[model samples]
Target: MLRAQRAARPTAVRIDGIVKSFGGACAADGISFEIERGTIHALLGGNGSGKSTTIKILAGVYQADAGAIEVAGVRHDARTFSPRQAWDAGLRFVHQQQTTFADLTIAENLAIGHRFETSAGGRVRWRAQHRRAQQVLDQFGIDADPRDELAHCGIATQTMVAIARALQGVEQGDERVLVLDEPTAPLPPGEVRLLLAALRRFSRDGQTILYVTHRLGEVVEIADQATVLRDGSVVGRLDEGEIDHDRLVELIMGKRVQAVLSQHTRARRGDVLLECDDVVGGPVRGASLSVSAGEVVAVAGLLGSGRSSLLRLVAGDLRREAGAIRLAGQPVDFSGPRHATDAGVAYSPEDRLASAAFLDLSVRDNIGIASVGDYFRRGILNHRAERRDARRLLSEFWVKAASTEVPLSTMSGGNQQKALLVRWLRLHPRLLLLDEPTQGVDVGARAEIWQLVRNAVDAGAAALVVLSDFEELVEVCDRVVVLSAGRTVAELDCDGLSDGVLEHAVLSAERAAA
Candidate 1:
């Protein structure tokens, strides 16, 4: 009977001629696609290429100007669809940002958005809720206790809990479809493997998934079919047999771009701009590194290797326990981030959404906020000068926005990152600290960011970057510093660095230390 029902309805989601326009920009222009039931379908696109807009339309967050959406054997006009309607049609979404409360228990977080089990008197049944949450967790193979605080679990476990929660009310025979947007963006490589394995399990159990991500390798590994969107239009589609890395890159980029890092040769290497002498703070233990003027140094390590800790210590986000840091040969201890910023230093954190960007503010304000002093007159802001500077920075960074007045939340992740970088780079600091600068950005924007970093170094500012992508380290860094177990293990020049070489070096150091 289940097989018969599956045979009768083949498509889980069918979107036709979806069109969405934001003022003068047509985000989704005549987009069309179909996801077969019980298969993993991938949506690929560059930043501001209408991928998010189309997904939002399907999620009923935005009313499309014109389109038809058929989900779970139910059809709804995109022009008048609502969130409740989408929910009733069995569509669930796990957005890029995590949607869980750290302070709450796993059971409580799972109960959110779904109808909680309650007593006849309308009081919540805590015991039954924990059992139900545990069942969902077990179903997804997530090793977490329902009664445990979500903050106690690792990031990977928290992510799986969020996914399991989304599938809580869904029954075995229900024609529900899950949409995951960049689910693995924040995870480490090992955690990503675990999450993909669980997703494959869901696909095997006759569940349909629409996975959106910038990681092409994961797409080839997990997706059965892929639809590529470029500039608000469908450019290519690939079946399981055709989903190779090179082919997908060509389709999404519209060019055969090599992933090789450019060999950067600085014309003049000057004195040390920033130096960490036996820095010991947070997870860092006796770590030491240096960056010279016109040089870009990258810290490379696996998860828990203290890469982020080193950066935070230098940026003054963490207090140094023991050791000293010198900037431009002057020994200085920063009391806080503001002190760091005041002393000719700039830091771009890894968590862009939480730390770097101001979502509620306009793009103009985000870009020009740090430089407000330059546009001040007798304690009054020079509005015209501020806007003019914002416009110039927007144009210079190639941010795709209709105008500066729009909220920063409206722009794509890549554009927001560019704006954030522009915000700090305008300071012309003596030292720059960047953590995962292009973690969620698409390929095209990545090149632009690399150029921006290079430009900064060329203008005599030194940079220290922490990245998980070894390929990016090979391309962007003049030297790579490997850290293991909170200690500096080895330092290698990037003159002939390859991904394999860097990985082998880090792993070899880990094995030695073990």
Candidate 2:
């Protein structure tokens, strides 16, 4: 009956004929979709398919070239819609980045962008503000104290607080719409569950949520309705009964993609190319692993379980406190990343935007920066040779960019990642240390990246990868190493591995450690 009643509710938002373009690229080509009131409506698409552009237009970050947006049955010009107007109309957005300050109290974080409680004499009412924050926290099932610092709370709790802040003063009404843009992208497996539960609870309380995410599993779990976009046009819409993992992927990819299975026969494992004998550094508490030539070994763990730190330690980005690292049977200690690179090792960090990518530079520069010496002749840089090599690498890697001269930031997340891979592959490294190599890429791009890695491994290279998604781990890796509390707990072959089996191993190990 609740579902039936929700289905009968009026449309919370209706986007009609929305069109946005960027330098001949049609980002939102006559996009149209209707979000039902008090339902969790999902907007999904591949990277660069214009999901972000449409949301930005609705959020007033970008003005649509032509279209109309109807909120609560009243139509408004998309071109004239501003952020202030969107806020006034009860449309709120919670982005993927951590927007809330960890140093501030929960009450103070809530008070931002909203009028603080004050007396007529202009004195701030701290007690009243705390009381209101407590009420909001209680409404969201958050267990943290309102006066406590936000950093004291867990990641999921912090995200819930951000949602609570956006939803302040929003009641069970028709005008309210909360947009969550990849809210779980940065969260771990456990935290993602908590946030998804909170979202379901919010929808139950008549909160209209427009959720945007690439994780189809989350969509299957929470979304009552979903709209799929491809190449800036609406391709398909799925109702509650029709939303499934395979169906959603079909709509997103415009083809029936096979399940990510380890069907491709791997090359025979060669000699151990890289070995960490009880390696200790950063959060890695005596963790040990090994990767052989023609093999891909995956490090599987929850957040802060030393998955990334282990990779960094191997790449010489982190100082090794103890233990031995053997590269092709040589006991060598690298002082820094340059030493590791010089030793034919490539490492890609987890946070690509901050550590790996050069967003301000052109695609050509970003790709060729690592190998600039090869294009130098007698201390003079050869610009023509550099451009030629960059264009060849871009074409070889299947990177979709307008031109080599375009800024790297102008490319989609997937293309940027591909370009980064091209940079590393050009080095012809013997061992690849990749931390979440396909972190923010789409499904099609993810397949291409795996192919690229396979091509490298087939050519006498080895890869050690850290994957948060167990499904991806089982799909791409020949073996999985489980980490718990910065320790290697268990290892399993990927012959018949399932996410359930992998997760069970992780949880059991964590429980034993506890």
Q: Estimate TM-scores for all models.
A: 0.88, 0.95
Candidate number with greatest TM-score:
2
Per-candidate alpha-carbon RMSD to the true structure: 4.0, 2.1
Give the per-residue lDDT digits (tens) of candidate 1, residues 266-367: 426789989888899998998998899998999988778899988899888998999989999999888876789899899888887888789999999888
Weakest ten-residue segment in model 1 by summed lDDT = 1-10
Off by over 4 Å in 1: 1-9, 113-131, 169-171, 258-269, 302-305, 359-362, 376-392, 404-406, 495-514
Where does the lowest 10-residue lDDT sum fall in candidate 2? 1-10
Q: List the residue pairs that clash in candidate 1.
A: none
Which candidate number has the best lDDT?
A: 2
Q: Write the per-residue lDDT of candidate 2 for residues 1-514, one digit (tens) a residue.
A: 1244244578989999999999887898999999988899999999899999999999988999999988888788999889987887789999988789899999999999466899999998999998988888887889899888999887888899999888877755546899999898767677788899888888898899999988888998888999999999999999888889998889999999885436767568999988898988889998888889998999988777898999888888999999999999998788877788899998889888899789999999898878888888999999988888888888888998888999999888889999998888999999999999887677888888898998899899999998887877888889989899899989899978898898888888888988
At residue 347, give the lDDT of candidate 1: 88
Q: State the local distance difference test value for candidate 2.
A: 0.88
